[model samples]
Target chain A: MEILVAAILTIITAATPLLFAALGELVTEKSGVLNLGVEGMMVMGAIVGFAAVHYSGSATVAIFASMLAGASMAAIFGVLVLVFHASQVPTGLALTIFGIGLSALVGQSMIGVAYDGIPQLHIPVISDIPVIGEIFFSQDGLVYLSIFMVFAVMWFMNKTRAGLILRAVGDSHDAAHAMGYSVLKIRFLAVLFGGAMAGVGGAYLSLAYSPLWVEQMTAGRGWIALALVVFASWKVRRVLLGAYLFGGISILQLHAQALGIAVPSQVMSMLPYLATILVLVIISRDRSKIKLNAPASLGKPFHASR
Target chain B: MLPRLIKRQSPSKAMVYLSPILALLLTLLASIVLFLIMGVSPSGALHAFFVEPISSIYGLTELMVKATPLILIGVALSLGFRAGVWNIGAEGQLILGGLFGGATALFFYEKTGFYIIPLILIMGALGGIIWAGIVAFLKTRFNANEILTSLMLSYVAALLLNLLIHGPLKDPDGFNFPESRLFSDSALLPILYDGTRLHLGAVIALFFVGIGWILLSRTLLGYQIKVMGDAPAAGEHAGFSHSKIIWTTLLISGGAAGLAGAIEVSGPIGQLLPNISPGYGFAAIIVAYVGRLHPLGVLFAALLLALSYLGGETAQMKLNLPVAVTGVFQGLLLFFLLACDVLIQYKIRTSKKSESTIAPAVKSSIKSTSEVK
Candidate 1:
């Protein structure tokens, strides 16, 4: 029972960053922009957040700083893709490359600096319950925020009029433009929001999940989060499901050793990536489904008739 | 007034060539500001970053050595990018190639033969193909997204390289080091330059560039690739098989990346280690773009980017700057390249009246293209 709870906590810790990134990207894609720089943005956020905490000794400052760092990175991407009408795919790739490098340069001194992990949330009465309270209520503030975001995003994407407009822009930017909605404005904001979310996700890594700075430490989690968005088929609920599922798979490397599994650690580490490919293959095999759900203008450059 | 983009009657053919040059200039300008912000003297930093590295004859040869893999990979990636098949896993493919080629060298373990080097090179490419083949199969058969699959496989490939280095490939004579034994001279690539580290891979890279140029400019497959990228439906209607293009481009890229990996181990490093490349695969994407996705362009771009690698090392030693600055420069260059590419499609005008005059002409052209589609 103790082991299960411990594993569950590990899963939550692992899942939070992916959740934050994928959720942000989901909204961005819903608004008809494909920002492949999630990894870059997240890494930038990780360093900036780590540095913010190191200097300020405050989690709030760290989180906000990371968001600004990520949003700034996204703004570069936004200008290139939205304003200059550059190809979204390569521009996003460039953004990722730029973000990773900038983050490394910024975090040069912060390497090896450690911090006490972010404090967990506590409520007076609900926290006293056994396994349920421990599992549900004992997570850090960001974890709760992630859960709230899942619902908030679901509500925003589904029930809101703005969400409908965002979807319409994604489905047909020309139609949305004809309707007098600003496609670039919506996409640019969506991209910035995505960057901020990716930033918070990075903050979760440095501030909560290992609480230290490392170059390229986000590793391929940014890429995995990207795959998760595709696996979710742009649905918010599925994004939560996919993030946790990937998170669980990611923790398998740790648990495998504890369970005395004979596999090499390197091989164990390959599972999440390999599983990403497998899940992508499974989810993407249904072409009609993807075509039905994917935003019509997802990655296409929007050239407004001025 | 904010300058408005006036759509060109047609894409500027000259701007296609000019954009990369403009981008390079802009990157240099940005680097000056970056160095200033970092509290380093911009002139000294730029000198150390670019000019100092290639000042000597040996440094020039070393630049070629670094560029060989980039040229090989960049050429292949350019081809793939033209076809809209994003194979971003060249890093994994390169690693697998090294592993395969290195394993072959290990298998022979001191055998002397003229054929050994060629065999090792073939095995290297085969290794890359086998890795990228997984991506191709998943993409073609399962309808999986190539971008994510290829990238995911790269991580898997890296771990696979680590696992091998720690286990089966570990040198028996060395003290538990996570690396393979030094390859025999017979397994190594022949040196091209008499006094420097320049190897046969540089020549091979040049040879492939020529072939890539010829294939791209002079073949039906090239035309098919262009049509497929520009309009997939049109390509299909023209009876070009989409799957075939995907397979051809991927295999070509995978093979090229693998060959580069093999050459690295055989030519300069002469042994296998956990990290054989400094993100050469990823960097080649920038090379392909900045080179304008043309074979001849990729060759020059590869050399320029290769200088960045050397400059990073020099800057680390001289300016006390972090080596991450190289990556920052590469990324910035690509960003500037993409931004500059805007000139190819549109003309910028500051005059407010120009928008009204140009809008109708551009709208009609846009409508015609949509109608054709």
Candidate 2:
């Protein structure tokens, strides 16, 4: 039972980043712009967040620094895809490559650097609870923020008037354009929002998760976040579930190895990736489900020339 | 008001040729700023980056050595990209090809036969196809997106390579290191020049480029690919098979990438390591785009990009600049190129009288909520 609780805690730490990133991307896609630069933005956020904390030693400033770095990366992507009307897929790929390279260069000085992690909340009564307190109340500020954002985004995307405008733009840009909506403006803002979320998620890696700087430290978590957005079928609630599910799978592998499973460690590392393929295939099989939810203008470049 | 962009009746030929040059010049300017930030003399840094790499004959040979794999992969990927098939799994395929080729050499350890090298190359090419075949099959049968599947498979391939190198393929007497024994002379590719690593692979890459130019410009399969990419429904209606194009392009790209991998191990590397081909696969994607997805263009682009690899090393050693500069340059160059390509389609007209044109968009936004109501 203790093992299960520990595993769950590890899973939350693992999943929170994915949830933050996926939630941001979900909102972006809902607005009809497909930004494939989540991975790139996340890495930039990670490096910037680390450098900020290393210099400033303030957690609040670090988180904000990550968001700005991610936003700047997205702004580059925006210039290419939005203003210049470049193909979204190629532009996003370029952004990611650029991000990875930029991070490597920027974080060169921070290599082998370590830091004190972000602090966990210490509420009075909630801190005294038995299993629940250990599981939830005493978690870091970012974990709570991530959970709050999930619900907040759910509310914003579903109940708010501005959220409808974003969704309408994504569903059909032409129709949205016909009605006089600035498709590019809405999509650009959505992209920025997505980038900021990805930034926070990336900052979590350096500030909370590993508590150190490393080259390409986000690894393939950014890609996994992208997959999570799809696996959830672009639904906010489902995205939360998908992130945890993947996080669970990831920690489960680590636990299996620790418990003396005979599988080679390299092979064990492949479980999450293989499972991603499996989940993707399963999700993609239901074409209608994907079709019903995926924004019609998700990846298509909105020319606005018409 | 923003300058009104008007669509050209036809793509500007001048922009098509001029954009790459502009992107390169812009990249040079960006490099200057990057250098200034690092407290280095921009001119000296530029000299080290662009001029120092190919100033030596040996450096030139190394440039060709790097260009060989890139050109081979780029030429092959161009065909697939043009046909609307995303085969990002070239890296994985290359690894498999290298693994197959390396395993073959090890299988015939100490064996001497002329047929052995040719056999290994063919097996490597075959290995690439079989690896890519999984993506083609999945996309055709299950309607899966090749982009995601191919990427996932690449990770799997890397792990598979790690597993083998650490276990079965570990050098027998090398203290449990995760690498294979060096290839016998019979297994290695013949050298092209004395005192240089340049080998038969460069020549083979050139031959593939020539073949690619011919296939793209003078074949029915090439026409079918273009038609399908531009209008899939129309191509389907006209009896062109979508599945056939997908399989064909994926196989060709996979085979080419595989051949590049085979050549790398047999020619320059001459043995398998845990990680082979430092992202020649991803780099080739940029090569294809920067080349405008043309075979001849990819050849020149590959050489230029290969120069960046050498220049990066030069900069790192001479000025203490990080080698990550190459990746930054690559990404930046592609961004500028993509942005510059916009000039081909739209003529930027700075008209003072553009206010009338911009009025409708402002008015229509206020009307959007009504339709929803």
TM-score against truth, every candidate: 0.97, 0.96
Query: What lDDT score is found at residue A128 in candidate 1?
Result: 65
List candidate 1 segments past 4 Å from native.
A124-128, B352-373
Model 2's TM-score against the true structure: 0.96
Residue-wise C-alpha lDDT for candidate 1, range A40-144, written one tens digit per residue? 999999999999989998888888999998899989999999999899889988988888899899989998887998888888789768789899888888999
Which pairs of residues collide in model 1? none
- The best candidate by DockQ is 1
TM-score, predicted candidate 1 vs. hidden true structure: 0.97
Per-candidate local distance difference test: 0.93, 0.88
Q: Looking at candidate 1, what is the lDDT of residue A178?
A: 95
Cand. 2 Cα-lDDT: 0.88
| Residue runs of model 2 more than 4 Å from their true location after superposition | B353-373
Choose the strongest candidate by TM-score.
1
Q: Which candidate is the best by lDDT?
A: 1
Q: Residue A38 in candidate 2 has what lDDT?
A: 89
